[model samples]
Target: MAVKVKKIERKKMPFLERIYIFYIIAGMARTFRHFIRNLLNTKNIEFLEYPEQKPEDITPRYRGLHRLTKYESGELKCVACDMCATACPAKCIYIEACEVEGSKEKAPKVFNIDLLECVFCGLCVEACPKDAIRMDSGIFTKVEGKREDFISDINELSSRKRGDF
Candidate 1:
């Protein structure tokens, strides 16, 4: 079946509208208004000194940095199933499985998540059958220098404690 297409009349743009003069002026005016308001009331402005000042608004469900959970015996909860890596949409998670010395289960010898590439979607946490990985560190990922600094290794992830957050 052939679909009937509707022909709509196009409005002719005026010289000022075509040039976006009014839109630009409106934007500039809004910017200047905010600037003037801020300038006049500097004390009213609230700026959180991040890293030093923890945001009070961070809810319980806030997905922050990634961390690996440990068992009561201090061993990592991860079983090297590669579920998290498989579920990651960004393909940021990397895991090298090693056979545990005394157990039949495998453990991650080199579990690493590149924070730079991570979307912080919490999919890895959900996909894990062991509940090994979590994004509830409450500490926001921050890297100042070196791209390699953003990669969180197994040791770093496991070392993160609940109190640290």
Candidate 2:
């Protein structure tokens, strides 16, 4: 099949439009207008003194940070089943299993979650059969400092309290 090529003629732009002075001025005017409106209507703007005043809108279902729960006997609830690691889509969870001292049960010798790679999907919590892993600590994940700081290990995950943001 032969294809027909059709060319459309474009109209030449005027000097003012070509230079873009009008567009720049218009953008500046819009910015100034918004700035003036926002400045004058400051009462509508809400500000929180963060770290000092937490927002009240954080819902109960909000998944903040990962934490490892403990049993009443002061033992880790995780049996090192590796279900959370397997269920992680980002592959950020790492678990190394070790046999419990006197029992046939196994436990994690090294359980680490890289916060940088974690998608915070809460799949780890759902995958855990023992209900060891939870994302309901309410401690916000603040990204700061070195790469090594972002990795949450067994001790760190186990020790996180509810208010330790």
Candidate 3:
């Protein structure tokens, strides 16, 4: 038995289409129409006066920044299982676990997340079994001068409180 292979050939475009001037002119005409329409009717303009005005509301589901939750007793909710760190695909999460002073559960002594490397996949939040981590603070990570500023420490994460948004 012999296998037969067919070679696929692409059709060549015409000279005018190859030059693309017609398409460019059509696009320019469309842009000019829009410009003229917008100029004639200023009401068609759609833009916010940012800095002076902000968007009304941020959706509850918006994943902004990471924050560590706490129990009512002021103790961290995290058991320091390192599940979140382990689950992070970016390897941006770092944790140093230590036994809690009075409790049998382990707690993170040094928890830091490098936002620069973080892809914001929300995997860390999902992997947290104790409901310890969340990305609901509604605070967008800011531009920092130094790379070191991007690494959020345990205190910064744990200091976030509910309703802070």
Candidate 4:
């Protein structure tokens, strides 16, 4: 049975919520803490110049930018079971599976994820049963002028994971 939800009447916040001094104080405190820590231990902070000095040693479990995985045999690892597509809250992932000879499951013939459509919420990564998709590889692909170029294939995504980028 469906329950009807009443329309909520939103009210203006109190003067504190509106002015938000508490939030400012908290942020300032955090910033001051970081500032003091950095001042004390100059080499302790992990910072990169970005685009110029990228972090060379990211943790293995670090949640990286994004990646579509592949098997070591040069075959696509994604089974195209639609888990990623379904799991995506943005509904950005699309898959068209095709059968291979002697294979019980179907592989993606046309697998596309719209970066413009993706929130990078990591739902797709968590949904992958085979660990065939991961965003923890420490590699980030650049978006191009052509929207179609952002629709990366398993092969292209896999090649980057293959180490010779």
Task: Tell me, by TM-score, which candidate is best.
Answer: 1
- List, residue by residue over 48-133, the lDDT tens digit for candidate 3: 77534655676677787799998889888988899998999999999999997777889999999999999989999999999999
> What would the TM-score be for candidate 3 when compared with the true structure?
0.77
Cα-based lDDT for every prediction: 0.89, 0.91, 0.87, 0.77
* Candidate 2: clashing pairs of residues: none
Per-residue lDDT tens digits for candidate 1, residues 1-165, read: 999999999999888889998899999999999999999999999999887888888778889888889889988899999999999999999999999988999999999999999998999999999998888887884855999988989988998865344
How close is every model to the real structure, measured as TM-score?
0.91, 0.77, 0.77, 0.61
Model 3 steric clash pairs: none
Candidate 4 stretches with Cα past 4 Å from truth are: 1-48, 55-62, 141-143, 162-165
Q: Residue 20: error of model 1 in Å?
A: 1.3
Whose lDDT is greatest here? 2
**What does the lDDT come to for candidate 3?**
0.87
| Residue-wise C-alpha lDDT for candidate 2, range 1-165, written one tens digit per residue | 999999999999999989999989999999999899999999988799876788798887788889899988989999999999999999999999999889999999999999999999999999999999999888774767899999999999999765533
Going through the candidates in order, what is the number of backbone clashes in each?
Answer: 0, 0, 0, 0
RMSD (Å) per prediction:
1.8, 4.0, 3.0, 7.3
lDDT-wise, the better of 1 and 2 is: 2
